[model samples]
Target: MNDAVHSIAAKSAAPLPKSAGVTGRTNDPARTMAEILKVATHEFADKGLAGARIDEIAAATRTSKRMIYYYFGSKEGLYIAVLEESYRRVRSIESELNLENLPPEEALRTLVGFTFDHHNGNQDYVRLVMSENMLRGQYIAQSKSIQALNVPAIRSIRDLYDRGVVEGVFRPGVDPIDIHANISALTFFNVSNQYTFSQIFKHQMQDPQVLAQRRANVIDVLVRYLRA
Candidate 1:
């Protein structure tokens, strides 16, 4: 009960480092928004907007319902934000690829492979997009941010297409939008219809072997279509 015991007690009672609370909420707005979006992304993707509950999302996040509303204005606003973040994440990763460094054919093939892998890995993103489309893009249409996010995606394709055409490796008059559509369609179908397709064909669509073969086939189809 003397100085030594008092020192030991004080030391034991002292707070830990800020990083010790790594998972705890902090004043960083970005982290808070990210935490909310991470939880909301799953909720919306699983249940869609109409079925997702604000209270449930708030419960899943470190933040509260009021905080969520404060950051996103409304449930619809939060839904749009989730969609925006989901798209942003995949597109951001795509932007990081050194596409310009690779040859045109390699770049396009790399892109197709990457897109196929990204869609499969991020099934939540695929579901979110499907839910948005099912609503005829009702919530997605509300966000001007998503369009801005997608512009660079199309620009990347256009640049790749232009380079390929100039190199005489790609056919002339290829549309970037069509290129995106083909790649997206091939990749998206794998995730979007995975359940139904698997059931219909009794095939294990989620198998790693199946995915690898499909990935190669998708790249081959795009490469063949683009080749001059």
Candidate 2:
């Protein structure tokens, strides 16, 4: 991985306390918002939209359902907030790669490696995202913030594709959006469905060595396909 990607992975993997006050007071609005989001993420991941409960989130966060409503407006609003926040965090990490500065192949490798590491490390986030998509993204699209966060990343990938074509590293016919979807599907599907994947494959999918090999294979395939 490149230095930027490595830096982000390191920061994400670093251990964090269960609760940290963003505003230096447990009940401060910012701190409370953070706590509520953390709890909501876990709740949504463990239980799909149909299964998640605001009351459980309130109790887990040591806050009230009224406070959650006051802060996020509604259950759908809270779900959107969690989705937006999750996307923001992932996008922030992705932005650090600066693929514009690297050669085409190296840039592709960096992106694939970063994506694989991210999903592998944050399985719960992956589950929550997949669960949302399973519901056809009705909730996510309602969040203007989530919609807005996607433009920069999409533009960045297009810029990279342009660069690769100019350098004769990738075929001129490739669509940037297609490339993005391919990468996302490859990295996300297996991890998001690890339990079923393991059952089908008849092995423990959580083995560290197996995951490392999977990441390597994903990068190799993506790089070869782009270079071809």
Among these predictions, the greatest TM-score belongs to 1
Backbone clashes in model 1, listed as residue pairs: none
Per-candidate alpha-carbon RMSD to the true structure: 11.2, 8.8
Candidate 1 lowest-lDDT run of ten: 1-10
Per-model TM against the reference: 0.87, 0.85
Candidate 1: residue 115 Cα off by (Å)? 0.5
Off by over 4 Å in 1: 1-25
lDDT, model 2: 0.78
| Candidate 1 C-alpha lDDT tens digits along 1-228 | 123322322333344234323355656656666788899999999998889999898877756776666567678877877887888898899999989888999999999999999999999999999998889987776676689899999999999999999999999987899999999999999999999999999998899999899999999999999999
